[model samples]
Target: MKAMTYERFGNADVLELKEVPDAHPGSDSVLVQVKAASINPVDYKVRQGHLKGLIDTVFPVIPAWDVSGVVVKPGLDTPEFEVGDEILAYARKDFISNGTLAELVEVPVRTAVHKPKELSFEEAAALPLTGLTALQTVRRAGVSAGQRVLIHAAAGGVGSFATQLAVLAGARVVGTASERNHEYLRSLGAEPVTYGDDLVESARALAPEGFDVILDFAGHSAMQTVPDLLRDGGIVASITDHRARDVYGGQYVWVRPDRANLAELAGLAARGSLKIEIAEVFDLAEAAEAYRKLETGHVRGKIVVRV
Candidate 1:
């Protein structure tokens, strides 16, 4: 099978298109003939060796974790899916080896879920990682109805999903984005604030007393203000910095794959409650170019790669 592979840790320059051995499913997994895959920040970070100390990696690694495809074969021990089943998965493992940017991928049955019939393969591929990240982060922050919620990087992949889910949960959402995306955020039922000098003040102006919840998807110093932005007993969650625990008594969230959550999201998408925005699409052979675009760090939603 052909895939985007890297010989060693580096930038997008290390990735190349190459034909490799076919990926076979493990006893509890399923072999998916990938129709589409999605790129996430973690893909590039792994390529750059930023996660070297964390997840184990094998040489000539395939890069990506989100995939939507049809099952060509189900593992001997996996009865959840059979041949011809269309599915989607956040195909992450304890170690980084096989990945989703390929013609075929082996996904653990535990994390693979039935694809939402209402979604195209690209749309199905786009949902798993970012949607789960946003959903779990919001849940960790314990967002609820009538609360004031603030989301950083509100127009980016995870942020967009977070904003919508928060609104659906009945929270008054305040999202940070450039002025160009303010209207974009508003359409998602969020009040937008520009990200800059007076971000905290701007956020304060909206909720004078303090926000009930703060979720920061944008790393860097944007979270430095969370300690001051929240109302008493309010919670904070950060996907970028675990140090949020020390600074604001908040949770630092890392999204994990869960079939139940994915299926629930599939239901939401099917019902028109969850919207996925595809910023761009690339062919599987163009994985390197896709990584270049992702590294720019400004995609409004998800980027998909058709296989």
Candidate 2:
């Protein structure tokens, strides 16, 4: 199998395409022949060793978590999948060694889900991580029908999904992005507000009484904006801020793989209730360029690598 790997933590420049040996799976896993895989900001962050203390790493690491592919081999006890089954997963592991940025990846059954029939391989590959983050984050913030929710970075990967899911849940959604993405957010049913100098006031202008819940997928900017945006007793959840919990008495989220949740997201995508935007698609060997583009933080949607 050919895959991209890095012998040490650095940047996209350190990654190289190499012919690696095939991977075998444990009894609870499935061996997937990769069709498409998507890159997240974490992919580049992990490549640069940002999460070094939290996640153990090995040399020659293949870095990625999102995968959309066909199951070529199911491990002995993995009845959830079989040969020829199309699958997708957030495919993260307890430790870093093998990943989905390759021609073949071993996915644990717990992280795998059937792909949405309506989505192409690239679109299916885009959902697992970003979609799950948005779903879990909004839920943590107690988003529900009739509630006014504020989402930071609403046009980016996680925020885009958050906006749609919040709207699907019947929440009045307001998302923050650049002016360029305002129309895009409106199409997704969110009231788009631009980010910058007066974000707090801009958000307040949209919801005078304050938002019922706020989901921060951007950064600590939420920490500064939450006081003005969230109503008293309103909840908050953040994937990017560790300081959010202490300041807002809210949840600091780290997304975990849940098969049921993945299935639900897939169903939503299939039903046209959720939309995935593929900002760019690169061939597998162009993974280094993919990671670099993802690191730019300006990508409007998911970046995919077709294997």
What are the runs in model 1 whose C-alpha is more than 4 Å off?
Answer: none
Give the alpha-carbon lDDT of every model. Answer: 0.92, 0.91
**Candidate 1 structure quality by residue, lDDT tens digits, 189-248:** 999999899998898999998999999899998877876788898888999998778777
**Candidate 2's residue-wise lDDT over 145-218, tens digit each?**
99999988999999999999999999999999999999999999999888888888888899999989888899
Q: Count the backbone clashes (under 3 Å) in each candidate.
A: 0, 0
For candidate 2, the TM-score is: 0.98
TM per candidate: 0.98, 0.98
What does the lDDT read for residue 306 in candidate 1?
99
- Which candidate number would show the highest lDDT if scored against the true structure? 1
